[model samples]
Target: MRCYVVGGAVRDRLLGLPVSDHDWVVVGATVDDMLSRGFRAVGKDFPVFLHPRTHEEYALARTERKTGHGYKGFAFHASPDVTLEEDLARRDLTINAIAEDEHGSLVDPYGGQRDIAARVFRHVSPAFAEDPVRILRLARFAARFSDFVVAPETMALMRQMVDAGEVDHLVAERVWQEISRGLMSERPSRMIEVLRECGALARLLPEVDALFGVPQPAKYHPEVDTGAHLGLVLDAAARRGESLPVRFAALVHDLGKGETPEHILPHHYGHEGRGVALAEAVCERLRVPAECREVGVMTTREHGIVHQAMELRPATMAKLFARCDVLRRPERFEQMLAACACDFYGRPGYDMRDYPQIERLRVGMRAYVGVDAGAIARVLEDKSKIPQAVAEARAAAVADALRAA
Candidate 1:
């Protein structure tokens, strides 16, 4: 059986990035042949196996035919006669269609190497429209590789796909996967622009799309509209390469602003709370992970907590930390602060001078609520007597610190 490394592993290696996983395409081999060769047969619908030695995935050369609708309704053909080139050609993107021989010889039947060199993302074939998830993948690729632009023909195909209602065929899980990856990328804001151009954003996140032309009060948002302000925060958060939940927090932190009442002096009095509910709805709709949903909700609900903390007494600081112990990690807490900061600073007409006050508030909170596990535990144990619990918890925490020191 002849096998060659295919898809992302080869593409990532060519890009000089760390390849975490490898997928092999086995030509001239059947599922039984792989099983006989010590590979573990695993796939239920397709001929896929895990290599006995490397534990890498080895998918038998196969072709798919659409049987019904969406990604799930696909019929696959796997035979010994299938070639690696055939399998590669079936991929969505040109850059991902390249394969590598066992000797590391490059395979570029579709000029994928040239496209990679040109820093362009192109469709391998006009058949890209067959799978609607490719549209989301294209947007995500744009976000991940900011230097690479989608080829014009590919963009045209994407628009056609959307126009044909192919996007409606995608499952929520696949859509969320691409979106989460884009949000975690270095140019998530750019992804929104790309999605908008392709009409994918309107289908996936109409809540966000609704903000595009909605005008915020000029006093607070002078740079552009609400959409532009949100884009700025997304761009800033992407630059930071924060964790998935944190990045999501940043991406959707101000989603409630669309519902904010407009007036002479516009203000979203409880937008943070509104945003929490919206974010939860988004998570439910997208079927995101529970932890991610929790973090997103927390970030949105408490996006303004840092500002409120600034005007509080020491007791308030103690109480606030006790209440939000879920934000124990310094990085996580900083990410929350960054989400808040980006929301405030990236607004259209925000006054940069006001940041000093915010920074002062952040610094005070950090200093006052230095990690006190005992305080958190006491607060958790005795919610009835908060003051006494805080005193005991503080003393216990100090003793523990001294012991550690």
Candidate 2:
């Protein structure tokens, strides 16, 4: 049996990147051969095992044939006869198809190293069209390697796949997985652009797709198009090194503006409430995690209020903090504020502009977040007065912050 260090570990090593995980492809090896050698079986769909010592994944070299539609519709053939070149041919990108042997010999059957030198993302073979998830993978790779350009032929093939209705069959979980990774990439806007260009954005994220041509007030948004503004915000979030939840909130914070009636052209008066429902729909459809979804929803609903922090009355500011449940999840509240800050400075000329409203809200929340409503209730005979008394104290504290500011 011959084992080679293959896939990501080899690719990243060739590119001088830090290798996080290693995968091995065992050629001329059978299931029993692996089992007798102390490898533990772990793969459900194919022949994959874990090394008894290192616990790294070892997949048997195999070839596949398209049997149906979507990513999962495939019949696999694995045997001692399967060649290393055959297994590499089945990979999506040429740059990822390279492998290395134990003697430090590089296997470059598909010209992966040449493409890497040219900074091109090219497909390995015609079999690339068989899996719809490759489109998302390619986009994510584009985001991670921001300097690499997709080959024109590869882009044409992706367009053909989209036109053939293959992308529509992709499952929600895979879509979310790829999109979330793309969002956290070095240049997330490139992922959105690639998806939009291939028409997958409209199929998987229609709410976000609708924002492209929608107009916004030119004064507030120098970019004018709501979709363009979202891209800017997402890039800003990346530049800020913001967390995933904050990045996601920046991506969805302007969805309500997409639904604004044409009569209101420049002004999105009530977009926040409309945005809340759309954000919830997006979160539900993608099956986003609870922490991420909660911040997204809160940012969608209260970002406008947070934007006008300097103008809101102390009582209103206190109520907004209460509505957001900032006392319980202070970190999430900070994330929400960061998302709002991404919105404020994401525009063309406003990239470096200051939004002091964030610090004001932070200071104001710190002042009253410790107030105890239950403790105040004991001093008042009327139970309803307790809420009022706490509100008053919080408001007074916020008012002091406002005055200090």
Candidate 3:
């Protein structure tokens, strides 16, 4: 049996990025032979083994051929005769197909090194169309490699995949996996743009696609359109380097603008509640993890809470703070502010001078909702004392503030 490091480990090593996980491909090896060598066979449909010592994956050399529809209907052939080049050639992208021997000998059968050097993302073969999931993967890669551009031919092939309805073949879990990665990226806006160009965004997130060209009152929003405004927020969110959930909230924070009534002066009246529902639906559709979905939905629902809290009494402020205590994670709150700022700033022709009130509100929030140790301890104490006279008083004060806002 012969084994070589493959996939991201090799690609990342070449790129000088920190590599945490390593996957190996075992050529000239069979499942029985691996078992005899003390490797535990794990994969049900394919021959995958876990090394007894390192516990890293060692998948047997296999080739895939499309049997019918989509990515699932594939026939796989595993044999000792399959060469490393053949295995790499069947991978989705050139940058991911490079393999390295144990001694660090480079294998570049598909010009992956050249593509990586040129900062280009290109599919390994025309067979890229056989799997619809590749489109999402390609978009995710674009998000990860912000400096890289997809080759024109690869873009055309993606368009062909989109036209063939292959994009719909991806499961919600797979889509969410790619989406989460993109949201965590340094340039998630690139994913949105690439997905839009490839027509995958419209199918996966039609609500977001509907934001395109939706009119906002010119007085408040001088930006090109709602889609453009959202893109700005995405860019800002990416810059913040927030966690995945918070970034997702930022990405979808203004999605409800599409549903704003034409007669509304600002074009986003009551959008917080609408956005919450939209975010919830989108997260559910994508089957996001429960905690992430909850945070995204709650953040969307309470996006306007900060604005509402500005006029509250001290007692009301305490209750508002308590209610949103979990959200006071500084990074997440800052991310939310960044999104809100981007939304406000992105409005076309709107003067920066016009929004001094938002800045003031942010300062007030920082004072009242800070995430100091004392504040967290107070929240924990308050949780056990719920329904007390003081809690009731605080809730009433907060209610009054909500009415005033």
* lDDT, candidates in the order shown: 0.76, 0.91, 0.76
Question: What would the per-residue lDDT of candidate 1 be over residues 1-405, giving only the tens digit for each residue?
Answer: 888888888888899999999998899987778888899988999988998889999999988887776777788899998888888878999899988888989888999999989999999987688888888888988888889988999889889888888888888899889999998888888789889989888887877886787666677667558788888888766655567777788767777876776662256678787777778888988998876776677677777766664455545544544555624554455566666766676665553446543455445445445555465666475666765655555545434433343
Worst 10 residues of 2 by lDDT: 366-375
Lowest summed lDDT across 10 adjacent residues in model 1 is found at 396-405
Question: In model 2, which residue pairs have backbone atoms overlapping below 3 Å?
Answer: none
Q: Over 4 Å off in model 3, which ranges?
A: 217-224, 263-266, 308-392, 395-405
Q: Please give the distance, in angstroms, between residue 44's alpha carbon in candidate 2 and its true position after superposition.
A: 0.4
Candidate 1 lDDT score at position 403: 35
Candidate 2 ranges with C-alpha deviation above 4 Å: none
TM-score of each: 0.81, 0.96, 0.81
Task: Judge candidate 3 at residue 89 and give its lDDT.
Answer: 83
Name the best candidate (by lDDT): 2
Better of 1 and 2 by lDDT: 2
- For model 1 the TM-score comes to 0.81
**Per-residue lDDT tens digits of candidate 2, residues 13-54?**
888999989999999999999999999999988999999999
